[model samples]
Target: MRFSVFTLFPELLRPFTQEALLGRAAARGLLAFDLIDLREYAGNRWRKVDDAPYGGGAGMVIRVDVAAAALESLEAVPDEVILLTPAGQRFDQKMAEELAQQNHLALLCGRYEGFDARVETLVTREVSLGDFVMMGGEAAAACLLEAVARLRPGVIGDEQSWRADSYSSGLLDYPEYTRPAEWRAQAVPEVLQGGNHAAIERWRRDRALERTLARRPDLLATAGLTPQDSAALLSAGLSAEQLAQVGAPPPPRKSRKKTPAPAVPES
Candidate 1:
């Protein structure tokens, strides 16, 4: 896959492109990336890419002219043109999987307060990391890139790796251990050391369900659990009662009682 990032701060994205998994993807030709400096598209003396909003807001908006020009320079139409902003669809693992299947991706990293509303008209889609805001969209873009990269054909060696990852099937992953069975007085699960593949698989599934139930019950709503899976979870010490709590809403807090007024001092 080919990813193109148009940003005012291209340097902010360099670190990710040069290290760890991303770096490996680049080296192995599993993925390709191009960082286009949005400032470069500004031909004026100061090379400005933002301007005060027409309605006069606290922060400057990305100028439509410069942003449009930057996008035009890409020549070919990307499979998806993603604009990073807080107002768009929430990005997630499913979206990452969809993006990895695309032939090309163009990411526009909004800066200042936000992108001009007109900029949205050109992009094919928009995505937001979550509810909170960030200093810039560069980090969001990097996140999107990493998620997509990991799903590429050769980027990850194990095909079954992602399938078992947290949220891959709406359930969190089970605990994992390696090296010497004993570490810091905590021993690895005995089932893991037993070399019984069937038991290990059953144990992992149950643990994954338990972990999800404990940490993120909201996930269980869409877990699509089967009767066999439920039995497995129960056998692993998690009862139907415990599984019931997975998606249960917390009870409302009790209101505090008001203090009584003191009797009048004057007679």
Candidate 2:
């Protein structure tokens, strides 16, 4: 996937992309980045890309003309142009998956108070990291980029790793342990150590359901639960009524095998 980042401070984005998973992906050509300096599009001799809002706001607003010009300079139009701002749709795993399917993306990072309202016209979508405000959108752009890029095929060393990531399956990830089986007097779950593939899978699913139920029951409302999932959650101590509240069907009842009457001493 190709990503074009428009920011006044391209320096902030460079260090992140040059390290970790992103760096490896870029080196492998599985991902690409075009870091455009928004200041280059500034019309003034001073290269000023921001100005005080017309209505007299406290902080300067990124100029629409500069932002639009920077976008137009791209070699090819991106599949999606995203403007980062707090007023936009919330970014999530589903959105990341959707973006990974696109061939190219352009991320416009706003500085100062925000982008000029007209700047919205040039982008295909507006997205926000969360409800809070930040110094600028550069960091958000980096975060958004990493989220989308990792979903691309072969970017992550283990594809199953991403599938197990929190929210990938609409449930928080199950607990994970590594190396030292016993740490500080705490031992890893026996189910994990036992080499029973089926049992281990069951254990992971149950833990994931339980953790999601305890921490973020809200996600369960729309989560796609299989019969196995229902069974797991039910076995994890969630009552049928509680499961119903989250839209999960009741777990299937286990059939009881009646023991035949004991032979009367062969009489």
Which structure among the candidates has the greatest lDDT? Answer: 2
Error of 2 at 236 (Å): 3.6
Q: Write the per-residue lDDT of candidate 2 for residues 112-171, one digit (tens) a residue.
A: 888889988998999999999998999899989999999999998899899889999789
TM-scores of the candidates in the order shown: 0.86, 0.94
After superposition, the stretches of candidate 1 with alpha carbons farther than 4 Å from their true spots are 232-267
Candidate 2 overall lDDT versus native: 0.90
Q: How many Å off is the CA of 151 in candidate 2?
A: 0.7
- The clash count of every prediction, one per candidate, is 0, 0
Off-target runs (Cα >4 Å) in candidate 2 are 259-267
Model 2: weakest 10-residue lDDT segment is 245-254
Query: What does candidate 1 score in Cα RMSD to the true structure?
Result: 15.4
Residue 108 error for model 2, in Å? 0.5
